[model samples]
Target: MRETLLLLGARRLQVPAIHVARKMGIRVVAIDPSPDAPGLALADCGYVYDLADKKQCLDIAERERVNGVMTLAADFPTPMAAFIAQQLKLPGISPRTALLSTNKRHMRAALSDANVPCPISISARSLDEAIHAMKSIGGPVIFKPAVSQGGRGITRLEPEESLNSIKSAYEHASNATRGDGILVEEFVDGPEYSVEALTWDGLTTVVAVTEKLTSGYPHYVEIGHSQPPTCSTYDVEQLSRTASSGVAALGIDWSASHSEIRLTCMGPRVMEIGARLGGGYINTHLVPLSTNVDIVGAAIEIALGRKPKIEISLKNKAAAIRFLVAKPGIIQSISGIEDVKNLTSFNDIDIFVNPGDRVLPLSDADGRLGYVICTGENSKSAIEAAETAKSLISIKTV
Candidate 1:
């Protein structure tokens, strides 16, 4: 009999994972808050429920008699998946680990206790506390919500900034968190990278290192990513060690983890770890393109309490994804999309906006209008192809 898997978050980002699980002969029960979510259509059964509501999702899972539950590339769903898995005694990340991974304050404490290299951070609930944190940290610091995603409500405060600046940033962070506490930490300056891994039976395997490209400014939004970063073997090993240590520190026993690390002058310091696949098409496009690892299929198997095949089938090629961002206003038209798509080097092009749709300024990851994924003989070539495709396509907004 085919086992039923409870899949959370039926957004477009999760469609690939749902399709992969169904292809593996596993029945997928997808749930999301929106009834019209695209991925829900791919599941054997669909439910309209908030993914953050653990109790409801658990009840549904129980009624369905699901073998396991899991989520991919989402924030709220990860903890919910953990809760359901624990209730059913299934294979997944521990609920305690899920909470620690979702909250920045708790995650930092755990990492610091484990002697993991990361920024010194403190949690604050008010502007006065934030000011005190800035004074204590004694350097340029970043204000982030303890619980938020996609770089939403993240602000960097300079050393010479005034109280008003702190207050504004604090307010923004608080709003994004919906009054939840905020995390103020010393800003680590350096190149940032994302590590993808899968943990099975308490053992973590570092799958790939992704070089992250962000628009450097007041708000850091990921603009592009290339797999198998051009780094020395020693650096890769160091990053892998850091990622493994972080997973161990967070107590992620059986699940996929996305760890973000910054290579600073002092050394490599972990920024944050998401208890799911790395978003931005890294798992669906880049990781497999660079490492030949079937992360989605493996995740499905892991959720079903099966040991996944972890062999690297190909490591000679590379892949990259470049996001398309538009200026603030209404999208008048898009041109040269077909031209860019016709390029043999490009793998896929996804446009999220259309003419007459309102477009916001590039402040967060949600501001992306579309993206282009490309593969090449090497990382450098793949990156070049991504850049060329983005340049070739023009989004005209007024």
Candidate 2:
């Protein structure tokens, strides 16, 4: 049987990829540092290894002689995947390109050099440097880790805010860094969107554009996302074109990418790009339901050295996913999931936490315990259905 090596198999995004691979008659060798990961139970073989440990992952891949190695949703694993694929002469982005995609500073520099629309960015190795960059770039800036993902180490600073927060941001980033420093950039005021695409021979084909709604104001946690963005067709076209240009500038010939961008009054600015599927069920649920696109299968085909089958068989529909977050502490109980699941427009509901499981505040993507996906024929209806579902579910903590 053909074999595929899947890195960071602990995530929810890896689940669909593994399921799709199994249905295609491929044996999956799942690797993750967490032995108790739920996906490991379903894999044909499971190995416990740190995904960031490039040497360890590569050693296992070589020993297994896997046909292709891949990772989904996690930015840190991209470079490791690229390194292994490069060593094995398989289909993958170059290690340098993968690094650029993971590090915001490098990605912005590359995009700027290529004349692509991107936020003005500066690198800060120290607090003084960050202060200087903020002063130079003017106020209303975003301080982010050079390589952190899922908004773990991001802080948006206003002109009036003290520099004390920058130190905290720096410490948080330093705690997560291997060696790379922090990146600060001008905060673009606009609507945020995520563009999904697949590349073949350096040509990028837009898959779907998702309208992202975040917790406005102080916390920038992503509250929900929907497909077939509610923006004007012109805005959508511009976003697609800018996303394509950003991917092309990265020099990736064959791969899948999930890019986040902001549509400002000035224009569309590239936020960040990942050479993998979009996180939070964007690929598994929203894309398939709204676009009738089988992205997981296409990713597998691309990994196997074949052109991806890309086509949008459905249109004029919308799908939204809303995550349920809880206050910090242990989860006491959850109620109303069945009621929400019974709703006509609610397509699916998944709860990841048990009654006794500890829950964290909604800071980053990892803090989400579960999510509800709703669908409708229009954006308003879809958003309404999602809101209804969100209201039905109640998470209690102690």
Candidate 3:
């Protein structure tokens, strides 16, 4: 009999984890508010329940007699996962660690205490407090919801910009949060990178480092990601070390972590850490192609109280994912997807809309029309393949 895992959030991101878990012979029991969540159809069994309602979800977990609880590429569910595990006396990170990982103020303080390099950030719920923070940290600050995911409620405020505008940002952040405030952080100018790692039995291993592409200024919606970045071995090691240090600092074990880092002229500074799998298909598509690690399977094992084998089955190979773009308006038509699919190294693509759908301005990742995944002998080649394939797509908007 296979051990059952209660998966939180049966959306598109969690669908990959469901597939991987089922492939590994684990029975998946998924839950989401949406009865139509895609992963729900793929799981062995599922329930329509908001992941935030721990008691309701726990009732299902108990009913299923699940061996573990976990989520993928989602934030709010991480704490809920830890809660279920702790209540059931299972192997998992503490509830405190899960909550800490999601809240920016707590996460930064922990990193700072551990001497992990991170930006100067202050939490505020009022304009007066924000002004005080600005006075201390100066301008050109970034305002982010204390708890958020997928590039939501993030803003860049310039030095000359009106400080009063932060009030509106605060209101936005407060509403977006799960009962929290906002973080005013000194902007760290650098190339952004994301580290994917798995922590088991108190040991964290960095699996892959991905170079991030984003629409800069104000809302930084991620555009693309390429693994096996063109950096020296030492720098890569440093990135891994910084990420590892952050995981250790946050006491993240028995889980996979996605750490957002910025490599400034001074050094690498951790922007924030998500105590769950990286979103945007980074783990599902990019990690497997570039590093040859089935980490989605490994994460399930961790949630199942087992140490997953983390090994490099493939070396030097690279993978990349580029998002298809379009202007904000009603899409007249879409073309060239069939043509792009024929290109070498074109692994996958998904156009999110049909002709009648309206494309919104890029406020977050959802605004992205679609994406193309590709693999190659090197990072440059893989990125080129992905971008080339993407260039074939044309989304006419009015």
Candidate 4:
């Protein structure tokens, strides 16, 4: 059987790819360090291996003679994906560009040097250097791991906060990384949106523009996302253009790209770019529902050296997804999903956690319990439905 190698099989984004590949009659070989990864259950064959170990992934891919090797949602695994593809002579992006996408500092340097509109960034290996860099960059800066994903180890340090606290946050972020390095950048205060695009032969085709709503204060966790972003047509045009330029600058070819950008007063500044599908099921569920674009299928096609069939079948409607979060503690029970599904505006609800599972407060991707997806004729209606669905679900903790 022809096989496709999927790295980081536990990730939510990989689930859709596995489903799509299976439907297309392609066997999936899932690899991850975690044995309990959700995607393992659906894969035709599963292997437990650290995704960061490029040699192991390459060996397995070669052994299986996998047609393609790819990852969804996670940037750290891109390097491994590229390495496997390169070793197996499969279709994938170059290792240099994949490395650029994985490392924020390197990505920023490449984009900025190419004259792409990205925020100025600096790297610090220690807390002292991070503090000094923060002072030099001025206050209200965003500190994050140089090579992390899902908003882990990201903290916005305001000028009013104590230096000691800022240093602690930097240390915490650095310590969380596989490597002891942090990235500090000037916080571009503006509305944020993400552009999902697929590139073929160096030409980027914009798939969808997603407006991201996040908890504005201490934690920048994403609370919700709505498609056909509620921004002006002018802003949308700018975002698309900027995303295209950024993707080209990174030299990505025949790959799916998810880029986050802020509409700053100066113009659109790229927050970060990932050389993979969007997490939180944005590409899998939300994009298809909102734009009639089969992003998952397109990603698989691109990986297989096929041109994606991009079409805008669904129009004049919006779709939104809201994540359910709770205070830090063990989950006792969850109720109201049935009640939520019964609502007039309800569309779909997925719960990722079960009773007795310990839950953490919303800080990173892992903290989210589940998501409520809703659709409406317009963006406002979609957002309202999503919010209403969120309100219906109640999480109880002990």
lDDT against the true structure, per candidate, is 0.89, 0.82, 0.88, 0.84
Deviation (Å) of 47 in candidate 1: 0.3
Compared with the true structure, the alpha-carbon lDDT of candidate 3 equals 0.88
**Tens-place lDDT digits, model 3, residues 184-286:** 8999998989999999988998999999999998788899999988777877888999999999999997799999999999999998898898999899989
> For residues 1-398, what per-residue lDDT tens digits would candidate 2 score against the true structure?
56565545555568778888889888888887787776777888888888888788888888878777777677778888889899999887899988888887788888898899988888888888988888899868887778877777666888677757767766766565555788778889899999988887677889899999886554476878998899999999999999888898887667889989999999999988888888878888898888888887787777777787788966647999988888888888899988998988988888889888988767677777888999999878898899899988988999
Residue 22 lDDT, candidate 3, scale 0-100: 77
- Model 2: which residue pairs collide? none
lDDT of 2: 0.82
Q: In candidate 3, residue 82 scores what lDDT?
A: 91
TM-score of 3: 0.97
Better of 2 and 4 by lDDT: 4
Off by over 4 Å in 1: none
Give the alpha carbon lDDT tens digit for every residue of 126-240 in model 1: 8889999999999999999999899898899997898788889998899888335999989999888999999999988888999999987677889999987988788888888
Q: What does the lDDT read for residue 366 in candidate 1?
A: 92
Query: Which candidate ranks first by lDDT, i.e. highest?
Result: 1
Better of 1 and 3 by TM-score: 1
